[model samples]
Target: MIFRIVFLCLILLIIELYTFQVLKTLIKSKPALFSIQFISLLFLVYIVYSLMQFDRSVGQTQQMMFTMGLLLIVYVPKLILTLTLMGEDIYRLCVGSVNFFVDYDKSADFLNSRRKFVSQIGLGLAAVPFLSLIYGVTVGKYNYKVIKQRIFFPDLPDAFDGFTITQISDVHSGSFDNPEKINYAIDLVNEQNSDLILFTGDIVNTDAKEMHPWIETFNKIKKHEYGKYSVLGNHDYGEYVTWPTEAAKEDNFQAIKNLYGEIGFNLLLNEHTFIQKGEDKIALVGVENWGHNFKQAGDLSKASGQLKKEDFKILMSHDPSHWEHVVQHDDKHYHLTLSGHTHGMQFGIEIPGYFKWSLAQYVYKQWAGLYENLGRYVYVNRGFGFHAYPGRVGIMPEITVIELKKGVNVA
Candidate 1:
């Protein structure tokens, strides 16, 4: 882990030095010296911080540094927008509001234009952090904060009638130090009278202790009908933290498993169980963090062992990409799959629909909503507890209240 961190830092330091030298060579003028220096310093700090996160722990611990890094994801677009507008406004102001070339047929000096551009960029850069802070407190709160979005699966089986299932994903509990917010989330889940509670994955950030404070609230969850079930996310298996040795990391994973036991969840690691409602049978299957190109921890064949092909099935898998890539196309006739790894890119809803962009696009197509393929269905929860970013945006946190309707034709 130390070696990884040192290596990353060395690479970043080399790049930073190269960038500084290039900037020094480019800007012989004294006026723009400060801008170049400031940009170089910013790059240097970013590289240093990036290097600090290269721990053996791949989940919450590594990304924990990104609690602030995730802020960059939010502000980059805002910075671009601000810079663009500021440049245009400064251009108009300098050229007179009377529509420059068309009205007066005048061209400004190249140096003056360069100065104005740099000034605008500098102002925009400075304002980015401040604007991001303000926006994070205001609008950015929507990105990671828990907000309810009610959904009713039109064709839930009659055996699961009025089956209010509370769900949360990407908890990233490792990032939080207190239980106040977690308690509130738990209270909200309890208030819903859930027949079943499902947690998709990323339960802990990188350590089991991260969730220790919230164990009280998490254990208070009392949806006893079919009970709470969970699957491991990419974060839960000690993939992103530092330990004395590999055995120590394995112990950390076991600790998190025990934590889940305390929380009253049947943490399924590539397995299935049968839930009987009256005379009808509903099968619940859960797999580990078997995301696209991630660890192949999910084995539906093993989880579905001894189950018939025609049974009503519900799945708890971590990455929704699993649903898009594997579950939807798998030969196994799974009726419904529940997943929550996307966090909806921790961004807001889109203009036409909730289709968000950024890194989320490369993974799952139906990130935080319902999608149907042929006769199979998947519901990807946006998640409850905020992760390293510590807020919820447009997608909103979800606690689905689905009414299982009569058997629909499985055509």
Candidate 2:
């Protein structure tokens, strides 16, 4: 970890230096250059100072979040500028070499002209992402949006043919810095008034104590006609933060489980429950946190223990990888699986139907939105809250409303 931090710092310094080198021509005076360098240095100081306040052993807090956010806003564009500058240099070398042989007289002019043009273009394009990140921190992070989807399943129980489920995931309460905005999001969830509320996981960033301040606020979410149910995400296991003892860690884990009840959510841990509607019933299975690279505590087999193969099932597994690796091929054939662990990498371009893409997609096959395989379906929520980064970019906080439709499998 220490080596990683040092390596990252070295990389950041390199990018900052290269960016200032390119930016020099854009601001043509020595005094202006000094001013820019001074401001950049101050930003770097603020980032380092904010970071020093938090211990590495403890979970992240709002201060660290803003610090990182500042770095992202400034440095991400610089990183892009660095890459573009390198590409221009490569182009210049190629053209200059060709000119050295073909047109020796105009070689200097051609190389310099091309270099200036590319540098101008690179600096011009850098403003786009820089401004985007600034706006993301200011307004986009709390721009809560509802995404509605309808999934058709041939075997859906008639009683639940049009069952509406409002799903939210990855609350990460510890990272929340604004009460008014969070309260507004909670109210929006209640406004949906779906038949059931399913939370995939990551209620807290690290430990159960993070939820203490927001318990009452979130508990206000109007219970749906059926009920609110949740399953644990990887972060809910209290494994990220350091504990003094194993017993203390266990105590923290137990407290988190209890907190779910305090917030009016039925926390399912490797268990199956039935949502009965007069005569017909649907199976809801929830497992503990399970991920390929993270925790592996979830027991899908045990969670679906007594359910019949024909039962209409909805499994809530925090990580989409779980759905991709296990539930999709399970003999029980879970009709739908809900997840949110990827948080869509908290950044991505997502257009309802035309396009949806994120860096998270590269890591998790079922990262966000919906996926289908052999008739089974998985909907990965983009997450209801932010973490680590403090703000969201193109991928805003999400409240997913999915309506289940009973239909013939025409496909």
Candidate 3:
């Protein structure tokens, strides 16, 4: 732990020095420059202090969220500036080396003077994330977007063709601060009016109490014709923080599960049910939180008991890794899986139908949106709420509306 802290501090110091170089190059006013530097130092100190104050028993709190937000807002831009300046330094080194070998007079200078435009350009690039982080914390966290997806399945039940389902994931209720904004998001979910609604877990950050206040707000989500169901996410297990006792942890876990019922969802724990229409049926299977790096409570075999491989099934598994690693290969032939654990890292660029990218892709193959393998599909909702970082950037919180089409997609 001590070594990790020292390493982190060293990295911060280097980032500080490089960022300072940019400021010094751009701003000639010493007073103004010193003021900015002093403010930056204060933020650094505050971030470290706030992090130190984190209580394991208490877990996440609003202050901790603010501290995390401030840390990113302050340093992400600085890191960008640092990298940009480092690139210039590398260029300067190569030029200086070439000059030393060729011309003795030029070698006296050793290195070329830093270009003002380079510094300016670096600052310009840095401002994008700096402002973006600020906006994310202030406005983007609640910037909900309703995304519509149309997926085609050749073997889909005729009665279920064109069936619509709305999906929301990773609520992280503990991090929410704006009641009005949340209510608005709930209204948006209702506005979709899909035949079915599904919630892919992480209802609260760690404690069930975190969702208590919003229970009524979420209950506003009207009942669906096909029914509402949910499965647990890693955070719902309450394993991230220290608990007072085994009983306390277990009690918290149970309460977290009950939160789904309070919000009008059938909490499916390693079980399967059938949604029927005109004597035709499709299976709905749900499992506990199963993650490659976190929990492994989900049981595919248990969830799909008595169901045949050819049965058309829609699965609700919180983590996409469940589908990527296990479900997709299982002989049960899960036709469609819904998930939302990635939250697209709560930051990324998405241009629907054209491109989508996030840091989450490096970790989870199906980080966001739709993915398919051998006719099986998984739609990973970006998320309905923010988490550790306390905000969303380019990847706004999402409410997914998926339409099931009976025919194969041609385009």
> How much is the lDDT of residue 243 in candidate 3?
98
Write candidate 2's Cα lDDT for 1-411 as tens digits: 556666777887888877887877576798988888889889877876676566756778777788888889889888888988878778877887778777675626556443556667878788888888888888888999999998998788888988999999999999887899999999999999899999889989888889999999999998788999999888888887788899988998888888888989999999989999879999999999889888999998889897889988899999888888888988888989998999888888887789988899789988889899989999999999888887788899999999999996465
lDDT of 3: 0.91
In candidate 1, which residue ranges exceed 4 Å CA deviation?
Answer: 1-133, 137-157, 350-359, 407-411
For model 3 the local lDDT of residue 290 reads: 88
Score candidate 2 by TM-score against the native: 0.94
RMSD of each: 7.2, 2.2, 1.5
| lDDT by residue for model 3 (201-274), tens | 99999999999999999999999999999999999989989998999999999999889998999999999999
**Every model's TM-score:** 0.73, 0.94, 0.97
Candidate number of the best TM-score: 3
**Best-matching candidate per lDDT:** 3
lDDT of 1 by residue, 57-163 (tens): 45445345453554354344334544554565577576664545446645643223234445445445656555554554444533333333333444555666655
Q: Please give the CA lDDT of all the candidate structures.
A: 0.66, 0.86, 0.91
Measure candidate 3: CA RMSD. 1.5
